[model samples]
Target: MKDSFDDPPPVPPSERASLPDGLRFAFGTLTVLPARITRWDRPAARTGMACAPVAGLAVGLLAAVPGVLLLLLGGGPLLAAAVTVAVPAALTRGLHLDGLADTADGLGSAKPADAALRIMKQSDIGPFGVIALLIVLLVQTAALADVYADSWVRGALATVAAAVAGRLAMTLASREGVPAARPEGLGAAVAGVVPSRAAVAVTALVTAAAALAALPLGLPTALQYAASVLAALAAAEMLLRRCVRRFGGVTGDVFGALCEVAGTTALVLLALG
Candidate 1:
């Protein structure tokens, strides 16, 4: 709620020689916008995954601004909520949503893990994917609208919480115990990249910050929302386990689904928590 939204200046060529590599990679890869990337390396990948939440914070702040302005302009909460949902989708090129759809298609195939992975890999959307995306988007939109109608402050907080929740889900999806479902692609690149201790630290910090930001909802309610964030995190973790069991391990698509699932789950809870 009280942090800089400013993007850091590009690293000078001189500084690039000494600066850490993965920081820029996170922004460049996670968000649609351009960020200077140095050579790709395992350390860079690890750093990128570890600092994933910073990307969440940046985009989350951006996503909330339009909604906050709409509220102040008396444009009504529904419009603001719709904009809030649309902003991230636009910024990320809807990759997370695509992932959610693909994951759903794979799981809904009701085939074995190998067969399901094949379904997920196909470019075309399946009925399961379509339905899953619709439900997730509808629920997120409705919940965000309700919060915006109640309090713009809480609505803004919800936006930020959702962003961080997604990134936090990334950590869960790429945790130590998880393995890449394939030998190539994003899942292979980032799986197990984030350190265990760092994941816990980031998750705890984000959940606490979410709690503090929701304080306007009253102390008891704030605590409930905080607990809900944890529940969302737990849910995301369990989802990753299910993916592992169902698909043989985590995949790039799985990471995207985790982000959407975790973010939506947290936002929905914040609506009523």
Candidate 2:
């Protein structure tokens, strides 16, 4: 039998280059992308949600690769858009999509909070979830297609902005006042974890980065990027409010819904831009 003496020695954090724990948790929880975090430190996990935008930026960049490749190959815009939409889902194992569907089901049930939450917890998809997922995906794809049709440059920027917006929505939804609907799980771990000041700072940085990215396109386009981000944040606010009112607090599914809605809204707005 294995003995306690056989256990490996613990590696000190000093041996590492001050690896960002918040970033680790962000990547671990937000995407299936490769990020090494040797230890599952609880304190780090608590702050990780704040770094979700960084993960989202990675997701956006990777997701854009498919469309960018297709464009470089002279493929149809619709196909490129479809590929872009599929890449993030593929990378993340569709967890966010599943969450979006579940949250929709819960909210659409129109039942009391307990019954609604129970519906959300079920492994099966309800009619509302199915319809919501389908509609959101369709809208996002169509928007992306339109953007790609315009130019790959515009499309890429929009995709990145949308991706960042989605994570930013997750951050906003998890702010200090947002309560967890349940006593355990993701909601318990992340909801209300972000300080309001931190949220504002992170959001401002994201917005500034997005603006800088849009500068190459034009000042008007940069304004559009800002608008797109705002639209996403607004959608997230609505989703968060609904979750709070209906479920009495935030849930993991609610966070998922915020990401989807935020991403879709950002894409649509950017397409218009």
Candidate 3:
């Protein structure tokens, strides 16, 4: 599918400077919020991708509110988990889930890059896409359920960590040297826009923050949180490399897929801990 900002008209300098360009780009494109995107160039994308995790943090907090509320009000862990999982999907308008499905279809097709890309662009969901979505949602819900059963605080922390880790994957994916799969669309605009050093710095900061957030739970929990974030990023890197090799580079769909992969990985790791 074409990105909403694929060919956005230029915004006047005054309008562009009215809001922080990076944040506007981040929330505008990444969520169903009302943040207006004032710029669509590489500069905005660089800042947007760097701020992606901030957006994720917001989304995670929003999602956790209802689930935590439900658990506090006598709701079962399973139902609360389902709501927590559903909120993020609704907030993003299921863009990442759609991307995950499309990516699955493309990878499962086993066709040439061109043909697979064509398959991914189609509006219909193939068997691979259906199966991928089903499994991912199930795993995410189940992991959250287990965590929520332990305690609402841990569950909320897990949800936020997963959300942030997902966007952190996007930041790393956009680091210098990563290529876009096509010359047009979201991937082209943001791919390789962030410097490698900056991406690393963001990763470290996020990992530290995750550990610190869980510190009140215990030292072991704090270490587990940090490890989960790292593991999530590692999983995303593996998938990013595979997608680059298979499709030649990243796409909006690949970005979505990466978010889902990283989020799911983080939740699973947290549940295990």
Candidate 4:
């Protein structure tokens, strides 16, 4: 099977994008945000993946608002946590969750790569997909509820950190050397577009920022937040490796699975902390 997408025609240096263009691409592709993407070439994908955390941050903040308001209005922590979890799904139109379900079905099929990929592309969810979605959503909601019970501020910070961590996984997944499982669609467009060094730099920046965001809580909390980010990435990495071995590389479904895995791991760690 082919391991990568067929390259598009080379873009001229003069036609390359700036940072803003990349931001547009990130927001445009990653969320329901109104940002218009002006480019779709590899350079744009590189910038977009590098800026993915920024898009995640925006999504997190927006999602956090309602939960915070509900808490301020005396809503219970579980209710608040549910809303926080629901908002991101609404914003992304459940794209990631659907991806998670599809990926689960694919992996669970246990057939060869091509057969597994076909299973993933099917529209209907299978038993594995349903079970995976149920478990992940339950874990995310339960963990977040516990965090919210501790304090709303801590809960909000965890939500944001998880969101950022999820996108950070995408950045890492896009790093050069990762292959696309297919030769078309989102996986091909983004896979291997980001330089490894750039992905590392983005990861460091995001980890530092997450720790700094929790500093107001205390040094221990800050360190815990940093650890959560690392743990989240590690979880995502394990899944990515498995998908690569099982399916030959990544697809849109794999990316979605990575995001959810990372986000859930971050939330679980934050609750434990």
* Candidate 3 residue 268 C-alpha distance from true site, Å: 0.4
Assess candidate 4 and give its lDDT: 0.92
Error in Å for residue 182 of model 4: 0.6
TM-score winner, 1 or 2: 2
Model 2, 113-151: lDDT tens per residue? 999989999999999999998999999999999999999
lDDT of each: 0.81, 0.85, 0.93, 0.92
Model 1 lDDT per residue over 54-147, tens place? 7888888999999999999989999999999999999899988999999999888999988899999899999999999999999989999998
Tens digit of per-residue lDDT, candidate 4, span 242-272: 9999999899999989999999999999999
Task: Mark the 10 consecutive residues where model 1 has the least summed lDDT.
Answer: 1-10
Better of 1 and 4 by lDDT: 4
lDDT of 1 at 157: 84
Give the winner by TM-score: 4
RMSD of model 4, in Å?
3.4
lDDT of 3 by residue, 1-273 (tens): 233224434445653322388999989888897898988887788778989999999999999999999999999999999999999999999999999999999999999999999899899999999999999999999999999999999999999999999999999999877889989888898898876767878999999999999999999999999999999999999999999999999999999999999999999999997
Query: RMSDs, each prediction?
Result: 7.1, 8.2, 5.5, 3.4
